[model samples]
Target: MRAVLFAFALLLAPSAPVLAQALPYHIDPGAREIVPSLAAVPSIRFLTTADFPPFNFRDDKGELVGFNVDLARALCADLAITCTVQAWPWDQAARALEDRQGDALIAGLALTPQNGALFDFSQIYLMLPGRFVTPVAAASGFEPASLDGKRVAVRRGSTHAEFIRRYLPTAGLIQFDSEIMALDALSKGEADAYFGDAMRASFWLNEHVGCCEFAGEPYFRPDLFGDGLAVAVPAGADAVRQVIDYGLARLKRSGAYDELYLRWFPVSFY
Candidate 1:
């Protein structure tokens, strides 16, 4: 009987390490380890541009609403921190993080190597592949190579611009400050097609531009696009990065992230 009990104990010992690794990290709700300050520090300010809808935008009441805002709220709730949404121009918002004007940039901005050198990025939380959106009246059955000699409208400093320059260099690229402006250019017949994230392009097409249709398949340039959207923090903010990363990992694990994605973007991503 003693030999039998010893054998049973030996069998259970090997499983202990596996269980330990599966244990979730215990995070303090109201601590800087997971947020910024322990006691009532200013609410973490989220810098974003309200021009982009379905990602980040100002509602009729001047309230910030969209996927990024919802995600930020969830992260704040998990961290036991309060968040203040601030609307700034996209270029200014990027600069704000570098100038330390805000705690983080939650604008659903893509993570690129050029931006990485200026700011530290959290783990990518979502993926948005670019697509070509053109007027229905334009020649149908458009392909990537078919964009040759066509005028393409793209937002300045966007992956779409980078994509055109690299893959469709012969195409005339019209740069705009915001996605809305690009869509306007497409509507006004100033450009033959507008290239941008499929989700954003869909939103614009459905709500603003009725004559445009998505062309071909979604084009993904891993090198130019990097990963999905991540919160940008001031360089050297290791603590902030750690907290954001932990909260993001937890959100992904808790199934809350998918719910938020579905809430904002009803269309299938992949």
Candidate 2:
């Protein structure tokens, strides 16, 4: 939950934006139907870490509760199988799955070609794009060309920073040690804008009475953010992967994804 608080602290303006925020219906629109079948395994042991809030995190009761946890439960229900989500250090979770200590991994498992060789991943679920947060009156279009010559603040050495340097090189780059610092600089007019995690940027606007709003469209680089997070089934567990694919698609078509999304986000984090 510290990460959740940190997202809030980074964007401190605390006033609502003038724009009307809409439900993010564009999320995961590519889900396809899959016919589920019983896996050779009886139940799925889902490996996860509790540090990523809204995705997976421990509640005040120390219970594992969040979007990923609930989504796992929903997938299992759809598959008519039992699922046990276990938490560990984020670093160890992947090894635990590779060691065969867990049957699946579903805590923001980034899907990449290298990982694909080691594991079977379900379809994309959520993509966190880098976005620019700017003062409302200074709002710019959501495009790389729009950022040219603009002073952009970003966390030094972060994926967001790397993306800006690589893709939007013309933007005046201002590096900082922390996202909070970058955001503070943006609020104080030290920078023309802040570029970072879209969800956190959106939520930052949710809390602070808005001195600024997310500019342009959300930015994403597959090499940096991967092709979004997906459930990771053990290598060669084709049946299990198929079941996951089917279950997730069902959830998307049945509106379960939206329900779970709202339950966790509460505020618009688009």
Candidate 3:
């Protein structure tokens, strides 16, 4: 997710242009648009980092594994071309891709405005949310503005941190160095609430009883998260982009996407 001192989570790097505090969680199904040249592209080199789990990471056997890897394989199959999933260090990813070392990048990276000038990204397939987590008793029905004097905890310097400062300014902010620390603050009553990734919060709450529960709507903002995760390709690589779009569509249509999603993300972000 958004994991960095300067992380913008998948936007790890913008999430929302404005606060979309409430909206139905549905992505309309559509036909895949294909670029004829994608069929002619003999191979696709998928560049990704191995640190983002559930999306991209190395398994116990040291093999690259995760949603991105599976998707890359599926997209290659859709295009009827070979694809190699190569893991790269985070710092070198941009340079490597720009130098023509790889055809695409899919390490849970966001489609930021800055990235728009360097590469084109496929349609966003997944969007993580900024959520509020509070003790079950304290998780009363509330909205962002309702946290008038609540002390909220957050990972220091995360997109969610920024979201709270900008949107929930009335709530006091308690910054932690790590997610565990922030969550602990809520569990221990050191903080009245915790703001962060909805999916992660779901999984954590499900695992740790009496720890916390969802307190409000999941926030969706392009300026807050960047537009979710998409395949990044060389600029003008229309064929490659289209192929991925088509494959993702087929995956959704046939229920393969749901299956993979459950396999990796047992908890839903939405």
Best by TM-score: 2
Worst 10 residues of 2 by lDDT: 9-18
lDDT of each: 0.69, 0.74, 0.73
State in Å the error of residue 225, model 1. Answer: 4.8
Can you write out model 3's per-residue Cα lDDT over 197-236, one digit (the tens) per residue?
7766655664565666778667777777656778888889
- lDDT per residue for candidate 2 within 111-155, as digits (tens), equals 767877888877667776777888877774555577799899998
Off by over 4 Å in 1: 1-43, 130-197, 200-219, 224-226
Cα displacement (Å) at residue 214, model 1: 10
Cα lDDT of candidate 1 equals 0.69
RMSD of 1: 17.5
TM-scores, one per candidate: 0.56, 0.81, 0.79
RMSD of 2: 4.0
- Name the weakest run of 10 consecutive residues (lDDT summed) in model 3: 5-14
